[model samples]
Target: MDPTPPVPHDLSPPRDVPLRLRPPRHRVDPRARRWWLLRALASAGAVTVVIGVVWWLWEPARPWLTAPLVLAALWTAARAVVEPRVRYAVHRWEATDLAVYGLTGWLVREWRVAPLSRVQTVDAVRGPLEQALGLATLRVTTASSSGAISIRGLDADLAAELAERLTAVTEQTPGDAT
Candidate 1:
């Protein structure tokens, strides 16, 4: 067997860090969670209203039908209000590292990380609803067929900036297509 030892990870500032040991890319702006909550609330409200209207028209078992609708509305509203308040932590990308990570949850936190080098493309998609909300979705495509990982409900400017930055990094990497 060869007698070689692995190098320790150098923990230093951006200026002093080596090219390979730089911090990883990560960022989180959960400020737009309110929009998600609003959307969810709107959906629940629409469903409840539809059921109410149907009950008025059809005159079905009032208590049986309305009870579940009421419970669902309350539960959905509670989740909407509560989920957004959960903290989402994001980390910025580092020079040597390609991945950016984000973690979010109240009781059960979840983490998502993407490698900048693996990114095939970055796009800014603005839909009618997002346009009204002044938000955009940043999608990063990877080599896998599962489709891109998209983060939505981000401030337009911030999303654009992040997308541009990621694109630049991806293009600059060696062997990356022009």
Candidate 2:
């Protein structure tokens, strides 16, 4: 008198199933490129200045410092020119009822997904540079340390609205958010 239905013999997934996560649908605010550029240039300038000062002050170390100074200059040029564009092209984010998705990084990109059921908190952050550029970052925290996601370079208003929406959704969803 068994009532259970028989299991299907074919358990393999369909051949068309995607093997990797697709990129998030929305690109970050275009101004993010300028923000990143300014930040990179400022950092490079500071490091170059500091190294130049040390090289000047320490006469005995001048010969050894030459290599470092040259390397710093090269790095500065590359970062100021290349990193911002690459980062802008690579970074993207999207928020859906089921989950939040983010793609980040320039050198070693990472794709992240955080289900709404697991969301613990949503916060919008704007640093000095971001404020000046009218950009914000949305942080979605989850119970797992590695599950948290940050969607950077969003429009400030959009970020705030998204945060509020996410908060409301997470509240209504039936879960402990852990």
Candidate 3:
């Protein structure tokens, strides 16, 4: 009997293997909840300012506009309080030896799979809000513009780890050199 083993043509999971391409089940840093609340409050504040302006400038229209504006303010507050948790629940990402897989989105579900060979750069980006929350967003760029994807809301350290690992794997992949 021949003892040679079969070579893997690609790093992709077997067709029969159910796509376990979900992000790890770990919860995000607790501070993300506060960050989300802050953003929501900021939005509601803006709406409040607008309502105030309308009330001062158009006294006669106040009755008609006030209710909607107040409702809007309430909705904004509700969104701020509820959306972060909903987002956290829906967000998941996993770094496999062969590829990076993630499911992200609240209303529009997006599934991402970027093979190591196709990864061009892995960036760990943090804005003021993210930095304050000790979080980072990982962006994976590929040769094709449409192939790029970002995994947001990861802990800063975890994002770094994923970026470093992806970069290492990408550098070693064949046919990736210019």
Candidate 4:
């Protein structure tokens, strides 16, 4: 057998020396439930429309409609409960490249990497729904829309902070003056 020391698996103070930070990355906020709420509200609206049509027309196919509407309601309600919104607290530092990245989402994961030279604008937007929830969405625009990334469902303050940070990073990068 070769004489080699085994690497430590547990790295607590009493155990082994910790190699990395306790938490590698930090979460921006609790998962947002606004999207599912919107979806559920839309689904409910559809069901209302269908019910109104059935009542107004008295169609023979009303029985079949019941099943489909019931199914849709169940699905929408379930999605509202199961899918939670996710946000990320970005920690972007310089490496060899003039680039930064933003990560967001929970059920649907998204990563956006854009070179500082390519970033055109950073904006924080809040819609009616977002306003109701006191949340905002930060959009990072670049020369290429296909490479764009949006960080959604953040508290207004955090979204503004992120937008400022991104803008600052872009402005400070060399060779970006125009």
For each candidate, the alpha-carbon lDDT, in order, equals 0.58, 0.81, 0.71, 0.55
Q: Which stretches in model 2 have alpha-carbon errors above 4 Å?
A: 1-20
Instruction: State how far residue 83 of model 3 sits from its true place (Å).
Output: 0.3
Candidate 3 global lDDT: 0.71
Could you tell me every candidate's TM-score relative to the true structure?
0.68, 0.84, 0.75, 0.62
- Candidate 2's displacement at residue 4, Å, is 54
Instruction: Please write out the lDDT profile of model 2 over residues 119-148, one tens digit for every residue.
Output: 999999999999999999999999877967
Give residue 151's lDDT in candidate 3 (0 to 100): 78
Best by TM-score: 2
Question: 1 or 3, which is superior by TM-score?
Answer: 3
Q: Write the number of the candidate with greater lDDT, choosing between 1 and 2.
A: 2
2 against 3, candidate with superior TM-score: 2
Candidate 1 lDDT tens digits, 1-178: 2232332222223555433433334333444565667766778767877777776777656767788678777867766876555532332222123544444344674445555566789888887667777878777787646556676656677677767877777787554422
Model 4 stretches with alpha carbons more than 4 Å out: 1-24, 43-59, 85-100, 104-108, 145-147, 175-178
By TM-score rank, best first, the candidates go 2, 3, 1, 4
Return model 1's CA RMSD, one decimal: 10.2
Candidate 3 Cα errors over 4 Å, as ranges: 1-27, 56-58, 144-147
Could you give candidate 3's per-residue lDDT for residues 70-155 as a string of tens digits?
88777886768677777777776666556767677666888777766777789999988889889888888877656667878778
Which window of 10 residues has the lowest lDDT sum in candidate 2?
1-10
What TM-score would candidate 2 get against the native? 0.84
Q: How do the residues 1-178 of candidate 4 rate in per-residue lDDT, one tens digit apiece?
A: 2232332222113324322223222233343455446755677657756765774587786777777766766765555554442222232111112443456544554555666677788899988777777877767777874756566656678677667766776777676432
